[model samples]
Structure formats: structure tokens, C-alpha cells
Target: METQEANTKKVVVEKKPLEKVCIICAKGSLEDVYATLVMANGAVMEGIETNVFFTFFGLDGITKKQMNRLHTATTGNPAMRMPGGIPFPTMLGGLPGVETAVSGMMRKQMEELDMPPVDEFLEMITAGGGTIYACKLAIDMFKLEKKDLSDEVEDIITIGQFYELCDGDRTQIIFT
Candidate 1:
């Protein structure tokens, strides 16, 4: 009896069960876009089904003109930080190309950490069964056409549609 109990206790623990994640991206800036991407990647890594919904300013992330030209936050974002704990000046960020430069640096940092670029990251997620959707309201408000969206996007969906996708699972809704 004691031997049987010991054997039972020796069983290795399993990782957490896979959960479904619904990520909402509401901002168009590089930081916000990266935040959404990172979370999606994490969910994928943890064997979870993930869906990303881009709405409002967040739609810029998937737009044809701005996807790769995202800008970094210099001011008005309390989380913005420079190298070695330095705080970036809000004025500098307003200068032309500063945001682009900062965005490039952040991308490089991610690359150094062996993380994939946003484009390929989205590709990986979709290829791995994750889903991406653009917001209908945003597209209409911005006068955007389907042709203006990135090829990686799955479709343009309404808020109601997004809710429908979240149904019937232990789904977690997160807005970044």
C-alpha cells in the first residue's frame, strides 16, 4: 500500500490547460501594437487558441500604409522609457522621424530576443490556427477599403461577430 502511494505521488505535473484568448487592440501606436502581438504570441506558445480584434486606432496596425511604419510613444504615455532608466523627452518624440527611429530600436530589441517581426509573427499565429479580424466600424469610419488591409488579416468583422467567436469556450477577453 505504501509503495503504491509513493508511485502515485511521483507522477509529473502537467502544464496548465489550454485557454482561448480574445485580444482587443484599441491603439494604433507601436507600443500598443507590440503589446497586442506579444500577448498573442504568448497565448500561442502556451497552446491556447488566440483571436485578435483591431478596432479604432488599433486598425492602423493592420493597415497597408502604417503597419511597418508604426511610431513609438515619446510622451503622454507614462510607460515610455529610454535606455538605462532614462525618460524620453516628449518634445523629441514630436520631431519628424523620432518615432520611427524609436520604433526601429524597439523592433531590433525584439529581434535580439529572437522574437519574430510583426508581419511574420501574425503569419505564425494564423498558420498555427490563431485568427485575426479587423473592425467594421473602424474601416467605415476611416473610409478604408478591404484592399487597404494587410494580406495577413482574415476578415472584417463586426463587434457582434467578434462576440460570437468568443462564445462556448473558457475564453478570456483582453484589451490592450
Candidate 2:
């Protein structure tokens, strides 16, 4: 009898740790920016090389003028709900000053939870050795100069250069 059970071929690949994480932020909404910040900060804390690229409206997250004064999206947001989980009315969200008030309340809630503001969060990430970058194309499109960006921004580079930094086999590119 052929000893077929004695012959086996299998391949087991070793798992490799992440060497770097490149995060791309394309939206500037308060929630979107916070999501990117949380992910980048977490990766930095884990001792992984972290790089954040802010493009399109996401530039608002790093722009000196808008960073601290970001507002939560009120209109067209399906997740908006009342204190008791009642769906927030669409027309109510469009009312004047509603967004600002809601954003203020949200910020207050975040403060109570010890969540640092945008600027402070960026500082924390940088202090942990995470690098922040702005998209050159977006900067030019918005007619913004380098001085308009936060001090934490390492530089404004093109997508090509950003990809070069992401050249390692163990690197991951995440879009937030």
C-alpha cells in the first residue's frame, strides 16, 4: 500500500510585526479628525513608526486657523440623536446656531472625559515621535502658506514623497 499519509506538503508563513503605519486623513470634520488622531497616537504609543498625511479638507485639522475651532457635523449626519436616543430632526439641525451649540456641548463633554483639544492632541502625538505632514497639492489648492499650518507639521510634501516613506514591506497605509 502506498504510504500517502506519510507524505505531506505545507507552508507556514511567519507573522511579522508592523514596522510603520501611514495614515491619510481626507475629511476635516471634527469626528473624522479625531478618529485619525486617535489611531495615530495609539500607533505611536505602541512604538511603531507613525506618519500622518492630511489632504483635502483634512487640512483643517492641521490649519492654525481651524484646528482649535472645529465643529461637529450636524446636517446630513444619520448618527445624530437626542439625549434619549431619539432621532434628531433634519430641519432642527439646519437651524441657525444649532451646530455651534451642539459642538460646544460636545466639546464640553469631551473635556469632562479628559480628552485634550485638537492642538494639545497633536502636541502629544508629536512628543511621542509621530510625524505629521500636509499634502502639498491641497495646500496649494487652498491657497495656504506654510505658516498657516501648525508648528507640529514636519513639512508639506507630495503624495509621491509620502509613498516613498511608506516603502517598507511591513508598513501599512490607513485612510481615515
Candidate 3:
């Protein structure tokens, strides 16, 4: 019985190598920007080719002017907190200078935690061979010109063009 059991061996098969492409369409608040950067970095570290297509509010992270100015969620957003567990007063966020304060505090905390800024993280991914694109429709909708985006942006692409670019022999499409 021991000899029979030993003869019943299993064959371990190696995983097939696959190429993956990610299309990160970030369109949420600052948290979304952080999440997108983190995922993009992870993919790059794994040697997976990646592309980030920032549109709408997501573009804030790539905008030359607003990249560092993004604010934490306020208003009816339940995720935000003020000086303490005390709910962030909706009216306070509406005030002229409070948003900046909140955004600054958040940025400071993130820095102390050693997290890279969004733009810098994007740069790291690009340096690691990841691509970045700006959606043409979003640019037009926001009245943004190519000059308005960061120098790191590779190109402004229509959805069809982006799809064509991403299609390949052994690529998997991932939309985040």
C-alpha cells in the first residue's frame, strides 16, 4: 500500500506566462488617486505592462496645477473627519479656507507615513515602463488643452484608439 501510494504522484504544472495591461480610469476623490497609484506601482513591480487613463476628477492627480491641491472629501461624504471623530461640519468645508486646511493636513499625514505624492508615484511607474494617457473626451469636456496636463502624459487618446492600442496577442485588459 505504501509503495502504491508513493507511485500515485502528482504532476505540478508551471503557470503559463501572461502579459497584462491595465487601464486605470480613476474618477473619484483623492483616495482614488492614491489607490490608483498604489495599484499601478504594484503592477510595475510585478513586471506587468501598465497604462493609466485619467479622466474627469481622476485627472486631478495628473493636472500640473491641481495635483497637489486635491482636497479630502467633505460635505455629505461620511468618510471625512474633523479635529476628532466629530463629524466634519458640512458648512466648514464650504468656507473659503477650510478645504485647503483639510487637504494640507491630509497631505502632511501621508508624507509622514512615507507615501509618495501622486505625481511622483506616476513618474516612478512611467520610469518603470508604464504608460499614461489623458482621455480626449475628458479634456474637451473640461476645456483642457494638452498643455494643461503634466509633461509626463504620453498622449491624449480617444476610447477607440486606446482600445486599439491595448489589443494584443497575449494581453489581458483590466479596468480599475
The best candidate by TM-score is: 2
Ranking by lDDT: 2, 1, 3
What is the alpha-carbon RMSD of candidate 3 to the true structure? 3.4
How does model 3 score by TM-score?
0.81
lDDT of 3 by residue, 1-176 (tens): 87666666433444666566656665756777888878877788889877778887788878888876777766777767766688877887788887778878888999899888877877888999988898898888889988988888999988887787777666766555
TM-score of each: 0.83, 0.91, 0.81
Model 1 stretches with alpha carbons more than 4 Å out: 1-18
Q: Residue 159 of candidate 2: its Cα lDDT?
A: 99
Which has the greatest lDDT? 2
What is the model-wide C-alpha lDDT for candidate 1? 0.86
Better of 1 and 3 by TM-score: 1
**Local distance difference test, each candidate:** 0.86, 0.92, 0.78
lDDT of 1 by residue, 73-175 (tens): 7657667778898887788778888777888898888789987766777787788788899999999999998899888899999999999888755788999
Off by over 4 Å in 3: 1-18, 83-86, 168-176
Per the 3 Å backbone cut-off, how many clashing residue pairs does candidate 2 have? Answer: 0
Clashing pairs in 3: none
